[model samples]
Target: MVTAAIGGERPVRDIVPGDHLCLTFADDAEQRPVVTEYLSAGLSRGERVLCFVDRTTPGIVLDWLASTGVDTGAALLGGRLRLVPAADSYLASGRFDAAAMVGTVRREVDASLAEGFSGLRICGEMSWAVRESVGTAELARYEREVDAVFAGRPVSAVCQYDARLFGPDQLEVLDGCHRGSVEPPPLRGHDSLRLVPAGRAGRRRLRVIGTVDDRTHDHFVAALDAVLHRPGDVVLDLSALDFIDVAGLRALANAAARLGGHRRMRLAHPAPVLCEVVRLLGWDRTPGLVLLPEGDVA
Candidate 1:
């Protein structure tokens, strides 16, 4: 059934140029320079610019923004260049935590908005971010809320997304958000899951080369279950996977547990993103863990 709106038209633009500029970048590297260019231009115009993103590649954003070009010197002059949580991140990441991540931005941006200005020019990935309550039901809730940001301001919004990841269901969910033709990002490393032969006989590995969400997790879990029965190791390669919320992370931990009891459970090449989440939640202290060079060892 049609539970949400499809990618029809974007009726609102909440970004304002005088004070703030917000953008949702595609999940890659090259598009980031574009984001920085916008920031530099906004800063040059004495506007406060805040870019929204998840925890996967914080360094990528910072590095690109600080590089020469786009005139960020003015932003530094005015102390306007900042990185704030994209909208609805309050719900995505706890308020306290999100606030911590962008505290500097909050103080400066809030000051700008408070001083004879309009509202906040917030932006973020709007595909599946909802006002949530609890449980996996939250997944559905998030997939539904999409009110335009900077509701009443003279702002420009640019959203970058992956066409390959966009199926009918995902596109339909966008409903009324105006977007451009799909183009590949500069650093296109959004990899997919592939089965690789493991060392030794009868051992194959499952490598998810991109973000693993709840839905993907379910399928992965089932696939792992099927593979566990074979008398060999099924390694999970997480070098490319970026975003995984609490539930998804727990599911992987659980799967590892199961495999350990039966035969062998192994994870390899976890990017800093996965390792940080696992460490933040104290998963490292758990027993039967092998620490990979990248992530937890278990």
Candidate 2:
């Protein structure tokens, strides 16, 4: 039940058991880096790593892992890592069956524990369902039912979706079915700060991770400015943000002022210090800024 919306390799490396994640990638360039980090982390932690592959063969996957510095050959030799074909699992019976897939996952979890591994980590490329014409209902059912297999258990799974292959409506449906998603790449990235687009079409959200201090304040302002131009209110998810200085706070205030009265910039789950600063400066009553407490939906 440890649900989270994560972005980048740093967060992917922190994924734990019982967390089911959805990863919708724009292309292989985005997908491969995250997958590589996931597999490497699981293997390093001594978990049984299972990857269901589509759009790439097992051999290519191994090669890619090796190139990315994963100890693929050793992990495979030790039987701690498995590269499964989508056909052999998701479409084994010539069509997708939600019950059958759930059962398969349950069995794998049991088998992994029996093998004395720390836990089971699984990731699957989900394009096969679309290719095979699996009904959306069936796909959603599989995602929901699979949760039972991981809930409170030593199992973590990530379901990968290709954004290019799935339509917006379909992607939104699939997104709602999972507890969390592996976010798309950052709008801006650096050692000090990473600003990622967490917003969907109608719901504009941005995640600010790491530190936003003097060094990164300009980048933050630039990124935030671009988001402010879009229609609708903006939500800044600061749950993962470690630090933000006065310069960063000024950028937020300026952005809110520019938005006027029509649009707002909502700060969701901001740090205590940030809240205090806003209150002390009377920015909390700023016309275009909204402060949301933790657990309050934007």
Q: What is the TM-score of each candidate against the true structure?
A: 0.36, 0.64
* Per-residue lDDT of candidate 1, residues 119-199 (tens digit): 233334433232222332333233232222222343444443332233334433332233221121222222343333222
Cα lDDT tens digits for candidate 2, 1-298: 5543333222576676787877876556557777887887788778899999988678877887888777887899999999999888988788888899899989889989998998888999998887988877888899989987888887888888876667656767776677667655567567878877665422436788999888888788888866676555678899999998877888898889889768788889998889998888887887898888683644
Runs in model 2 lying further than 4 Å from the true structure? 1-10, 187-195, 200-298
For every model shown, the clashing-pair count is: 18, 0
**Clash pairs for candidate 2:** none
Q: List candidate 1 segments past 4 Å from native.
A: 1-30, 70-77, 85-89, 92-111, 116-149, 159-168, 178-298
